[model samples]
Structure formats: C-alpha cells, structure tokens
Target: MEAHGPHADDDLVTMLTRTGERVPHPDFDRYAEDLDAATLRRMWHDMTVVRGFDNEATSLQRQGELGLWVQSLGQEAAQIGSGHALNGNDFVFPSYREHGVALTRGVDLPEILRIFRGLQHGAWDPEAHRFHLYTLVIGAHSLHATGYAMAMDRDGLVGTGDPARDGAVVCYFGDGATSQGDVNEAMVFAAVHDAPVVFFVQNNQFAISEPVTRQSRVPLAQRGAGFGIPAVRVDGNDVVACYAVTRWALERARSGGGPVLIEAFTYRMGAHTTSDDPTRYRTRADESYWAERDPIARLDAYLSSLGELGDDAREAVAAEVKELGRRTRETVRSWEVPAVASMFEHVYAEPHATVDAERAWFERYERSFAEQGVHA
Candidate 1:
C-alpha cells in the first residue's frame, strides 16, 4: 500500500513530507511544536551520525573487519525518532540491526562493532543502558520486552506519574519477524496483561528478498488489532512523524493504556546484510523510488528552509560526522577479541559437570591442534 497523509481511513500517519513539507495534523503537530530548535538540530545530527557510522561499518565489513554487517541505511528516521522518544529508564529490546537505536542510547561504537566482529556475545549490559543485547534470534526480543514490561507492571512502577520511576518498554523488530510465532505470542501476552510495552515494527518493505505482501494480507500495523492492541501506521521516512507517533504510543502504554503497535512504513536501501546481494533480489527502480524519500534529505530541506542549517551549519555537522566515522573505524580496528577459552568460562553461571566436561574436551581439542602442528 502506498503511504499517505494522516487519516483514520487510510491508516497512514504522515506529519512530515519528503519535499520538506509538514502535513497538517492538529494533534501530532503539538509534538513538533514542542520541539525546540536545538532538539531538531540534534535529530538532524543523530541521523547524519548514524548514517556516517553505518557507511563506515559497511566499509569495514567489506574490508574484513567484521564477519557480517547489517546496514540501517534508509531506516534511520524510523529508528532514531523512536529511539529518542524513550526516556533513559525505559528499556529497549532490539533486533540485530538496530544500530541507530544503539547510537541514540549513547552506546559506544566499539561496543556495537564487537558482536559483528565476532568478539562478544553481548557488548553492553542491558540493565545498565536500558538497551538490551542485540537479539539475533529474530522475534525473540519481543517476548523479552513483554516479560520485562509485565514485571514493571507487577512492581506497580508503570503508572506512577513519575518520570524517573515510570517506565515503558520499547521492542524493535522488522516486518518479517511479525510472522514468527514468538512475536504473535508476545503481542498476545502483552495485551492480555496490559503490559507497558510498545511494539515498534519497521516495515522496510522486505523480509530479506521477500516483499511484505507475502508476509501479510493487510499492513503489518493491523496485526496488533487481532490481539486487542492499538496500532498506528506512520510515514517512517519522516522523522517528525515517527517521533510524534512513538511518543504517543509509549506515553499511552505508560499511562495504563496497554500495549500499542507502530508500523513504521519504510524501505531497506541495501542488502539484508554484507553477505547478501540486493541486486539479485530487488530492482533499481525500487531504489530510485525510495531515494526520493530519503529521510536525511527531507530533514536537511526543512532545516535549510528555516535558516537553521545554513551552509556553515551544514559544513560543521558534516565535519563532526566525518570525525565520528573516523573514530568509529579506528576504535573498531583496535578492539581485541577474547581468547577462545574465555567462551567456555562463561558457559554456565555456576560450575556444572556437563559444562566442565565440555570445557575439558574443548581444551583437549585445542591442545591437540598445537601438538599435531595444525593451522587452527
């Protein structure tokens, strides 16, 4: 389905336009009005910084610095806007490719690169950052988020009218994951318990090479309706729309409104990962079509029109992004991988006979490699 202006019948909410226009919305516009110049500028910075680092990471993967890389190239607005809407205390669960969300949460570059570089099972502590480890197992994180939110509810911490104490959970995933039983089960559990969770699905038009049509007869946003969750579709390319919609959803969940689902209508501009080839599965025409709706360009246009992003400001932001990219590249290159034996050390929280036996066998196998003069 094609994206359109915010309307109840169309079910697509568009507050910002690709041509640097602002869609008329009496309610949603309040969120934009409350945004100061500095905040808008920061959003612009966040998008550029994420884009710059994303490009650098992709390059590093091509250069063999990483085993695989997933680019958040075109979906920056969807991720960044929603990411920024969360408070520091609100927990976030991510799929493997939510680099933009990690950046928004103030995670360091090397910590994010460590997993793709095959160094760590989890680089950052979820309890510390309120951003959980990247859940590479597709839809598993949704269940995790729902469970956490349910705990928050049981603790009576969600609707306390306190910013620092009241917290909601945001779960990020792609359109394809919605088809998984885990995601559906999560939605059911969340709705049934009135869990303080917002399901943010970035419908990037593809689940690998398969189009979204093959995954659902209706739009993915409507999937929540079957489970009694309120869902809204947003123009994912428009950062303002994404932020406003996510803010509304999260606030609703925090205030005992139950789980809300937001389908961020977006397009993936690159391959599914460094190992995949977009040209083999997608068309050049599709790229051209989404190119015109580039989120960064749209924000730049609005900023430029308002004299907030003059040439000097643009140059300044560009320089900062370049430095960020450089630092990210350098830090990732300098990261040291843990020793192979260290993996076995953390296999169990407490020692177990089976784990000890496996570790002993693994050590024996490694020692044999040295004795046999093997290249392992």
Candidate 2:
C-alpha cells in the first residue's frame, strides 16, 4: 500500500469534518462504539495524568531541574490513543515529544524524566518496553522503524494468525519530520518491501514556526500514496478515532496486509520546547482556535453525552492529575546525577583506550570544579 492523491470518493471531506467539527457520523460512531464505560474512564484518567506530567516537566525545565522539555500539552489524544492501540509485542519508535505514548507503553515516567534531567542517554531498555529510545534526530526513527519491520518480516512475524506474535512496528513523528529525507527514504523502503509498519504522523499543523500547509502541497496522507502505502486521515484529538484507526492499521499489517500511513490531525498547544516561544511566530487566534477543539474537552463532551462523566469523576481525575504532577516533581528532584565516570560505560561493550583516557581527563577536570581556590 502506497501513498496516493486524495480520492474524491474516499471520504476525505467526512474525515476532515469529523476531526475539525467534532461531528457525529457513521465513521465516528463506529470508532466510538468500542469505548466501553471502563475504557473511556481509563482513557480520561491517562490523558489527565499525562497532561499533568507534561506541565510539571515543562516547569522543571524552567526551574533548572531539566535541561529541556518538549511539551505534548495539546497532542495527548493523538499519542495516548495510538499507544493504547498497540498489542504488547508491537514495537514503538518515537520522536522526543511522545511522553504520552511512552507512558502508555509502560516506560517509567521517572526514567523518561532522567533523560531530560541530563542523567542518562535513556533510562529504559528499549526491548523491555517494546518502545525505542526517544529519537531527537527528526525523522531518523522512521528508518529504524522500517528496518525493524523488515527484520520482523524476515523473521516471519506477520500473518501467523496469532495476533500477539503477528505484530507490526509503529513509528511516530511530527508534520515537520515528513520533510526529512530519512522519512521519505523510510516510506520508500516500507512500501517497496511491503514491511509491516505504521507511520503515525501527528500533524500538529506547525513545524516549529512553519505551518503544515507550507510543508505539503497536498494532504500529508497523499504523500504516502506515491510510495505505495494506503493512507488515512483521522481526528487526532478524538481519542476514539485515533485508537480505532491505529488498531485497524496494525491489525492489517500483522495479518500480512503490509504497511499503512495515518495522518493524525492535531495541534501543538505549547512551545516546540521550553526554549521556544510560539507567540513570536504564530498568532493568538491560531492558538485559541485549536484550544477550543481540545482533545480532552471533546472527550469530556462525549463522555458527558453518554452519562459517563460527572462532577465527581471530573474532580477525581483532576485531583489525580495534581497528585501525578506532585509525584513527578518530587521524584525528579530526588534523582541523583550519574557519576562522572559512568559516562564511558555504555559507549561500547569493550573499553576503547582513547575513550578511557578521555574519561580519566574528564574526571580530573570535573574534580577541579570542587577544589578549593577554583573560583576562576
């Protein structure tokens, strides 16, 4: 399945309306129908908790507890929904702003915090959580995902008829990442080889300061068509839609349907990172417009309509989010920085002489900062 131009017959208008207007239609209903009361509640809880974690991390960066922070304040549903759609065996390759996805994939929050706090390259083993380390090199992870899918295919990890073993790889990236050569290359490989992977693009409508329209002449999904991947656009802020579409694609891949591309229409509510100020590039009206169609708020409306959300539930979730924030702040504050010598440990399995010598010199230089009369 490769990318193609949007078809007049493919319901693009309906998909866009579902995402932008929050309309209730057959496609939206089909996706929403699977959300049981318990699952809906859980989704709400997870979103609230992750949002709290996001805000606290941003604050920590500002307060000097973290070197930097990537806020996912507005993209929680896009991440969390897709994450929850994965089976345990599915592999996830993520870009840096996927804290919600990492949380859903069971990566310890504190460990993810450790990376930004400058304590480790990454805190969790990728294999352990089926979640790769956060890739900061823009679209590079898409290549890794393509390779992983190829390996899975070679290993006969598809069409086993056993859903658990027949897992696919999912790589998450942003609208900006689509412009990268690595991403394009990955798409080419995935489509040509028919690898079992899903390219989940969270098109938050801006790449730093560039609007999404500037990045693509057509819709992003159409980009996949040229590469021979079946593509779909979904309401990223609608958790139900995100989960349903992702699950559908994953099931297809696992069952030997090859690759698919999903463009999650979303918005980035905060700065690109703590160091950025979106106000300098984007207008307040743009922010306000997206904020009104917030994923959480939309979910809240759906839940309320179903009689699943109430004052008690709302207050309880809010309190839990606050507690999550408090715990994250406390945990981050308590973590000890790694020893200066530990930096050389993971460079390679065997010690390299040059690295050892460099480490020794670094230790000496570090100790000088603690020595008396070192004010200069």
Candidate 3:
C-alpha cells in the first residue's frame, strides 16, 4: 500500500513506505551515525521503563492512587522515537497521552502522576524543558504550536541559515483529534505562514470507539495537501523509521522548508484512557493483530539481527525498568499533595482585586473549619 497520501506519486510513496523485510530507511543510517551503542541501549531501556511506568500508573488509578491515568502502553515507540528526535531547544506541544514524550523531555514522572492524581495542574515549567504543558482540550495544542512557530518566525529565530538556532515545534495529537476544527485551523495557519512546525498525528486506527475509516474517506496525510503542506506516512511501530522521519521533518522545518504532516501508522494497544475498555468496542483479534507488530518487539528483532540484543541484555533492561517503576511509584506516593492555597498561586503573577478577595475568603473559610475541629 502507498505509505503516504493519495496526492503523492509512486516515487514519494515508495520513499515513505516500509523499506525491506526489516523496513530500515537510509535516513535511519544517517541519523544512527550520531547515535552510539550506548544511546541505542539507553533508548531500549527508556522504552522499557516508560512502559513499566505506564502500567504502574494504570494500576494505581485502578487502585485509587490516581483519579485517572492515560495509558500509552502500545504507543511507546511513536512517543519515544519522536521525543528523542527533538533537541533541547525544540518545543513539544503534547496531547494527554504523551507520557513517554514527557519523560524523554526530563519532566519528572512523579510530576505527571501528580496531575492525574488531581493534586496539581501542571508540575513543570515549559521554559525549563521546552516541553509545553499537556493539552487535554483535544487539538487545541495544534494552534498553540502554530502560534509558537509564528513567534519564532517573527523573532527571526527560524531559517537563519543555521540549524542550531532555528528550532522546530512538534504538535502531537491522535487520529481522533484531526477531526477537531482547531486542528484544521492550525494546518491552515501553518501552511499559509510557512511555520517551522511538524503536525504529528499518531493514527492508531481508532479514535476512541470510532474507526479511522469513519473519520475520513482518504488517509489523514492526504488532508495536509489540501492545506498546501507536505505530508508523509511511516510505519510508526518501526522506531527507526519514526525517528528518521521526524528528524528529517524537523530539520526541513528548521531550514525554512515549512511544515510537514507525519501520519504515524501505529496502533493503540490499550484503551484510550484508564476509564475506557477496549473490549466494549473492539475484539481480541484486533488487539492481537497490533500486538504481533509490537514496536518494542520489532526493534528487538532488528537489534538481535545485528547481534546487539540478547537474552541477558533484555533481562538487564527489564530489571532496570522494574527498579525505575518502583522508584517512580514511591516518589509519586511520597509527593506532598500541594496545599489548597497553592491554587491561588500561579493564577496570575499580579493579583486582581476580585481574585484576592475570593482567595482571602476561601482561606479564612478553610481555617474556620480547622479551628472548629470539623471531622467528617
């Protein structure tokens, strides 16, 4: 099948399609040169740890340690591959399921746990890591990314003929979010302005209970062409392909090539979120199909073929991930739930009179309850 959109020719389609039996791309080779053996091993370990973390978070939600959890169990490669492809200067606008991306960008795992636990809003500063806060409002982050890119363009930060200073913005959303009006507007703005941004749509086949076929008659990448943006589709389960494609897109954007849409052909192995049940709408067969093409398993096969992975290494990675999960859980549980007063903070740098009065009243009300020794 043509990997890209209907608008692309056979040559472009072939260039974007899964390559060999292994599906390795030449771009992977170019980028792999910058990644050493240690980096590869770290990537493997990071995936394992993040998956473990995800599983633990889900379990915690089930056990009431969290109010909710968004599981990214099967989409690790899509997150990690694109996450690692970015530099420190690049900004990432993520949807709620980007736990792996958050981890890759150095957002503390416990901090994310705090969000789902209902103890905090967002625990990290965007300036500190260049990772924007998670956008639960579906495709809203797409516009935020477009605006950021426009700001970069205005500040002469893009296309300075220097790759180092020229940063790209990556906006992540699922196949479901593409249906949102904000997403369409974002593409329109991005294309018209030639913004240095990448619209990364992880097409996981289903948008909650709805299938991809129901969303559009044609592939999602094809939609980009209507907006005058170039697009590509890659086997998202293939980490090498994802990393290479994302790197290329970002590099192109940074070099004044404008925006690119990447439709990552992946599958959401788990439910949409912790509250969802896949069995309600999908069958075991469907789940098994994606499981068979598991991203980590595919990478393991490729690494083993190169004599880079073995049982011992796998076991070591597993052990490390296990420890990481344990530590994350402990840290999350030990975190002090922010005081109620904290809600008043960060609402505005300068306090408004109305907000100040309301906050003072709330504080007094809370203290009065304490003074009265009210125990429900």
Candidate 4:
C-alpha cells in the first residue's frame, strides 16, 4: 500500500504467479477476468515471437550486421501485455527496446532493423501506425508524448464518452529514465493539464550498468503519486497482470482522467545493449532469479494449464518462430546502405539553409575523394 517503500514489489498488482497460478487482486483482477484461453494463448505467441526476433537481432549485432542492438529478453510480457490493451487510435511513444510493442502495432519486423543497420533515419511512417519512431535520447519523448496528449485534449479527443472517438497516448520508457528531468517535467505538465497519457515504465532493474537501487530508494511508481498522478506497480513478468493494469490506465486517461504511471517489476536478462556487458556489474545469481520468472515461459505455463498450449501447438509456434528468425536474418543481410547524401534528408520537416550548406560541403568532399580514386 505504501508506494514510497524500499521494497517496491510488495505492493505489485499481479494476476498470475510465477508458477502460473491465477491469483486475485481485489481491484485489477476485474480488468483481466474477461481474458479467455484463446486470448491468453495469443499473448503467449506474441511474447514468443518477440523473443525470437530479439534473439536474432542480438545475434545479428554480434555478427557485425548491426551497429547496435537492444534485447527485450526478459521484458516481453510487459510490452506485449500493454500493447494488446491499446485501441487503434491510441498512439505509442516508445524508447528504443520495444520490439513487442512494434509487433503489436503491425509494424513490419524487418523495418525496425533499418535504423540499427544504418540504412535509414526512420523506417516506418508514424502516422500510418500511430507508433512513433524509437527515441534513443533518454527520456526526451515523454515531453513529446505529453505535448501530443495536450493537443489531443484541445482537439476534443478525450472524455467524449465515445469509445470509438476518444483516444489516449502511452509513452514507454524505463526505470532509469525516471531519474531524467524530462520525464518528471512531463508528469508535472500532464497532471496540471490532465493530459491523456499513460507513462509506462519498464523497471528492468538497471540503467546500463547502474542498478535501479542506485536511481531510487523508493518505488519509481511513487514519482507519479508525488506529481499528483495515480501510479501502480505490477508484476511485469506476468502478462495478464500487465495487460490488465494497462487497460485500467488507458481507460482512465481516455475518459478524461489525468496521466497514470505504471512501474513494471521486470528484469533485463541480457546486456543493456549489444555494446554493453551486464556481467561486469550484475551477478549470475541476479540473472538466475529473474530467469525463473521468464515472461514467455510464465504465460506458456498458464496457457498449458488451460489446455491451450499443447505439444502440437508448441511445435507449430516453434516453426513460426524459426521462420521469423530466418526472414529477419535474410532481410538484414540483404540490405544495402543508403546513399551518404540521404543523411541530409529528414534533418528537419523542411529544408534549412544550414543543412543545405552542409550537404554541399559533403558533396564537394565526396568529389575530392572521387578525384583521388578513393571512397568517401
């Protein structure tokens, strides 16, 4: 009940236990109670596919096909759960590492690789999917999300009592980003203006090498409560709990309630990125503790209990997962880098004098390299 406690998990909202047992939360269980066996199975499939794609991406990075890769190894349930809860009109602003969210938004999985492969500035149309391009500059997108939500309010998109017309925005960031000023400021603005945004924080236990403990002595969810916004912490590895909590938050925001903050108590099983070495800072014991709570496995177990995910179904899923990995590998390897001159494009919505000047300079530099019979 105490959001400011040292033990953050003590008040976690959970619908499924680590052993796949269904548990009841007096408040949130109602939100997830309607999920039947089929929906549960689909969630498991989503997590499995996302994990498979994530593994392939990490392998691609290791093989030097990608400049960098971020693994969502242990955070699948949190992403998939929240992703499933979104309405078609609800927009998503994700910090990089949200492959599950991208899949749920119907984004072509290969398109996500374009940025890491250094092929494009942004690979997908934001307006098309309502899923913005990944923002890697820390917590900057929280402000962007908040501003967008305020604009939505001005346009009469919130609290219309029309499920089809009302919309909300969900901004995905991490526990580490909670320490950033932009995230805090965004919360302040959202609370003041009652912006229809849900700030979902995936507390994967570390900011690169720094542990969550180093960032906050109390629960990260409490930060929202301090800003006069409602906050909830959920068992991130439990897919049902995550889906239910996000639905609760989204409903609140879409219906004119202020922003909500959700702290998903999950772990990042792999390195922060392909460029990071988590082993240098975290222990095997830490990894093992979370491994037992693997989100995909937990959901699979729950589905199995309902007689939904039998061995035959698993084999089918395995084949699909394998094909996904194969396609990802093939597509990434087949990509040709874009023209260096193309970098000047999309620097701004419209052409600027400075960008034009820089493009001209680059062109001249390339010509000099051509004259010398060398590549630029």
| Top-lDDT structure, candidate number | 4
For candidate 1, give the lDDT of residue 326: 84
Candidate 2 residue spans exceeding 4 A from truth: 1-33, 350-354, 357-376
lDDT of 1 at 260: 96
For candidate 2, write residues 62-130 as lDDT tens digits.
Answer: 999999998998898888888888998799999999988988988877679888988887889999899
The candidate that achieves the highest TM-score relative to the unseen native structure: 4
lDDT per residue as tens, model 1, 1-376: 3443221226568877889877777667776666776787889888888888889899999999999998999999998889888887689999988888998887875578889999887889778888999988989989999999999988988898887788899999998999899999999999999999999999888889887777876778777779999898898889898899988888888887889999998888888999888898778887998899999999888887787887777788789888987887889889887778788776777888987888889999999989999976
lDDT for each residue of candidate 3 in 199-234, tens digit (9 for 90 to 100): 999888778888777788787888988999999887
| Residue range 1-376, candidate 4, lDDT tens digits | 1235433677889889998988888998789877999888889888998888999998999999999998999999999999999998799999999999999999988789999987885799988999999999999999999999999999999999999899999999998899999999999999999999999999998889988878888888887778999999999999999999999999999999979999998989988999898889988987887889899888777787878889988899899999999999999998887788988988899879999999999999889988999963
Go through the candidates in order and give each one's C-alpha lDDT: 0.86, 0.83, 0.80, 0.90
All predictions: root-mean-square deviation over Cα? 2.5, 4.1, 3.3, 2.1
Best first by TM-score, ranked: 4, 1, 3, 2
**What is the Å distance of residue 55 in model 1 from its true position?**
0.5
TM-score of each: 0.94, 0.89, 0.90, 0.96
| TM match of model 3 to true structure | 0.90
Pairs with backbone N, CA or C atoms under 3 Å apart (clashes), candidate 4: none
